[model samples]
Target: MGELQVEKHVKYILAVEKRKDDFESVVMEHLRLNGAYWGLTTLDILGKLDAVDQDEVISWVMQCQHEDDIAGLQNEDGSFSGDMWGEVDTRFSYIAICSLALMRQLDKIDVGNAVKYIVSCKNVDGGFGCTPGAESHAGQIFCCVGALAITGSLHHVDKDLLGWWLCERQVKSGGLNGRPEKLPDVCYSWWVLSSLILIDRVHWIDKEKLAKFILDCQDKERGGISDRPDDAVDVFHTYFGVAGLSLLEYPGLKPIDPAYALPVSVVSKVILGK
Candidate 1:
């Protein structure tokens, strides 16, 4: 099944690479941390990282870093402001860090200042915000937690409060919401579940129901998951949908390392330099 998924991903990457779309163009220009992370992740899964210029790609990714000590930014502007808390988001920061780590350039980053920025994003509500002084969100919480875990600063987080906030994200349907009042979605299943896994609190959530809800979001005939029931299927949700289920130890899915946010299969190869 892993081999088949890799083949499917290779074909998908080929098709996407051939497209004359804005997605590819934007990724090249911005090297947006998330986009690069996704691209490299998929390629790594397919054992095709050599197809990309590792050095050039790493250089571009570093350029996206904000001099203001934030990890990812909406634009190259160093203004330290934006709609989502007027600063770089912790979510983007996690992706940026992961991307560099995948490329073995994690040492190039200012770990101390990056940790400071991530710490500042933590909200009193227990979850981390996209930026300082923003509302707590599940997605950003995953970012902050994932970042801290990767940087070996997990001890800095308030584990009790963070776990409480994550548990609060669960809804009757077993899906999770980014914020207090938003509707539950499959994406948060990844955010919240991953956070729980990192904090050793996975057993605290209803894994059975969460797995059912995530499966329900799948397009049975189409073979991909959507963000919500009846929504169009896309790559983003597809990846997280599988990942969310993987977290619950779903029978046929690969196990994802919550701390690094990568499938154990791929991470093993990375760590071993295989």
Candidate 2:
């Protein structure tokens, strides 16, 4: 496979944001805030974050959250809902923490309660679920573990056990699947790889093969990446593909913090106060 189409991928992400009437954009309207974060994070990883208006983007995020949509939406159990309706998930908890951490405002919410809620979602098998008593999933594990890491609470995680579970997500194809017996997908590269890195078990997976797997999913001529090879490319998979490459220490790409899911430069400046 050829190299990552960095310029093409950047163009694809920027174009998606402009094409408001497109299927992806329209359907993802309710998740506008999170979409902004993902897209911007992707751009940041590509070293093109300054291509957009930072002030305008910050203003837009503030406008999206009010009394209901984000703030005060945390449940009594300390988990967060994706929106005002209040459906809780560790995914939302991660998004909430990541977003707030980016804004330098993690203090606005009950961080203590959020950590407790995330810990409660941990399964005995050393994985995290979407919620308490739910089945462990790689995606949810990433979310919960990421939240805990950002809050400086890795002491709550059983690293050896969770690392074993995460490392097992890798399949024969060199790509990672979200759960056992599932076909490997490019998206899980970011989820699983990041989780493994956070828990210090990234060496458990075959990095070279994984790098090739993500590269093979790229649409060589058109840019963007798909969930798997010979499949339709989408912005979601494209972001993960590039991010996964970053995690693999791919040449010519920025390093991303596994826990924060942002560029090391940005994270150092914003979260780490460097």
lDDT of 1 by residue, 1-274 (tens): 1212444444554444445467655556443455456555645543556877789878977876665532343233211233347545666778667766766766666667777888887777777887778888787788888988888889988888889878888889888888777898888888899998888887777888888888777665544557887887555666676667777776655577887777777777886576
Clashing pairs in 2: none
For each candidate, what TM-score against the reference? 0.72, 0.89
TM-score of 1: 0.72
Worst 10-residue stretch by lDDT in candidate 2? 64-73
Q: 108-135 in candidate 2: lDDT tens per residue? A: 8999999999999999999999989999
